[model samples]
Target: MRSEPLRFFAWNLGLPLAIALAIFAVFDLTSLDEIISNWLYYPNHEFPFGHNRLFENLTHRWPRIIPDLTGEAAIIGSILSFIWPLMKPGKHDRLLRLLEALRIAPLLRFTARYRRDFLFIVVSFAVITGMIHFFKSHTSIYCPVETTLYGGTMEKKEWFENFSLFHEAGPGRCWPGGHASGGFTMVALYFVARRHQWRHARAILYASTLLGAIYGTTRVLQGWHFMSHTFWAGVIVWISALLTALAFYGWRRLASPAVQAPGSAPPAPEQALSGLG
Candidate 1:
């Protein structure tokens, strides 16, 4: 069978392939072992622990939840990608328009008009920063546990010898992955925007949740973070989502003047498309 040139090249050597090589090179040259050992074993000082045990326990369970969720998302995304082209042309166009509305321009404008959405972003940033500070202050407490769970007890020089294939860059430090938080935040926004459409809203909610879970799981498996970190990240994201929803709804009522009732379907596809033009 004939193959498209771009597809053939991408199949053989793509951006991911190049990135993988660069990562391997960095791993070989850096004294990652020494860094991990010093960070995990050598305690510089002591600090009060603030992390809740119950929360940590819940976070730890995140590792178990991610794989199943990720598998389902993968299956769904695959099906969507395959079937999208086979959809009616009009349906496909509508889908495209829906996605276009999600572009940065609209999102930014929406956030600008709504102080609450902006506030939510600020709060999420503050929360993330606070978590980082906590990690630094209580470094001695968490690092040891992180090392024992994710990093094996090996000499600095032999660290790579026992390295797991799943290990990704930034292991130990990149715990409570930002990626998972970002994914969940997107999910929340989708939920608020499409709440009236039961089936569609549920699909998006499930997909977004799956994405967040998968991202967190991958980080843990790669030894980039502990299960606890990912869990807290998800919690923070959920909080951010609630704030974002409030901001959006409040702003819509204030800015538009006309308070349209909730649960209204969006304009018809042709009307929406014409409005866009």
Candidate 2:
């Protein structure tokens, strides 16, 4: 099989991006946002926060912890990628000890070992967060908590409807569910496992996707975002990571002649093209 960046991009990023767009379109046309929001919210104009608002309180607390945990994880991955070669740790050193305490030592070790692959993971987190924030800042789409149905100020605007290119009211920072981006950023983990362990990569990819969905669902229940908002966040993150991985492989192929040669086999493959094909 040949190393083809366009083919890789089409399968890994283009298709998933199209799916995400379709999802956003379907939810917009069907008014599923309002429907789902209504189902989760009680007649009292409040979320079903459980007895005496236990769930509401819990959901509220998530905003505080989720960003720090996920952002710090991404930052750590990037930092470790840059510093892995410089720092050497013993079998049971403090860095590993700390990672073990956080239950992410295996991920840290894996990223350190496959440093190049992990670069895409780091890039994915940055790109996903940046794009989500850009939309959240520019788009005037209000969150469910801000909509009239939930007893807030603004009317519930569809994904592509509200906001002007020149001047628009910034209702609040509430589009695309930035909190959920944290979970979806785990899509980078998929790239780390994709090369040598295709099966494991599939499992990791699905698990990361599911984790993002669950995180987004939590935001939906809390009225901070609609289901579609979180869905798009996951989609964007996945696509960003996929494209970054494609770029990585493209660069590897260019840098190493053996990987690109028609009849030559490299020590480590520049790509595993069967899946992309």
Candidate 3:
């Protein structure tokens, strides 16, 4: 049997995923999407109408801000962290020299042990974001603002109903909340947390989830997406990160020797060598 920590980790990662799938299975999110979008949306006005009024304008466009901070900015920071050790600071200025030693040097040492894991995390982020964009382009789903519901031209669509991969519904390209994926991609931190200092990792995971949800909400407010789009984006990102972590950890586990019981006979050399042949 696996250890208790492993069991707990699996449960922690799994329960929400199960809930997400169940929600998608049983509920049609169109009506709720309309309700939320209508609440914030003002269809009649120009420049800043509907959900866009609050999220995109009144809040100084936090939808863009949050994703930039959490998504691209975070990824860039991770890359820099991984490479901080390789950076050769010139003896140019007292301020620059002091900053490099006090900040960059410590960060470099701290991140050195996790360099491989950091690379994996970055790759996972790229894959998840790339998948989101691919689906967004191919799914051919329109945004709420573009739909008739919010006074646009195209027909509104329920999740996965009458959907096609190649069909082009209209100019609307708002399926799966690409912006929300930016926030959801932060789940990479959760994968990193699995290795050590799990409490901190849990905190990071929660923070990332919350930020992603909030970012999705902002888009909904702008009538840019249905709630289902954002919800699916989060689920996709979580699942992607989970699979990535499992792939890495499972490979390591399989490569290591299994623990044997006391007085257990060692495997026959021929039997052990059989697979190689």
Whole-model lDDT per candidate? 0.43, 0.64, 0.63
Superior candidate under lDDT, 2 versus 3: 2
Task: Give the TM-score comparing model 3 with the true structure, all chains together.
Answer: 0.67
Mind giving the per-residue lDDT tens digits that candidate 2 earns over 76-163?
Answer: 6656644333334554467656766987655544445455654555566677777777777677677887778787878777656664
lDDT of 1: 0.43
> TM-scores of all models?
0.35, 0.69, 0.67
lDDT of 3 by residue, 69-160 (tens): 64554455556554444444353356446655777545543344345465667678778977776676666778877877667888876646
**Model 2: lDDT of residue 152:** 85
Give model 1's TM-score versus the native structure. 0.35
* Best model number under TM-score: 2
Give the residue spans of candidate 3 off by over 4 A: 2-14, 38-105, 162-171, 251-277
**Model 1 C-alpha lDDT per residue in residues 1-277, reported as the tens digit of each score:** 2345455335323534554455445543565433543454345321112144553345444543553353344344333333222334465777556656776333322322332333433444445445443432332223323444334452122223333333232333443455566455445434243423333665776776677776665444434444444555555555454445444444332222343467654443333332211
Between the candidate structures 2 and 3, which one is better when assessed by TM-score?
A: 2
Local lDDT at 165 for model 1: 35
lDDT of 1 at 166: 37
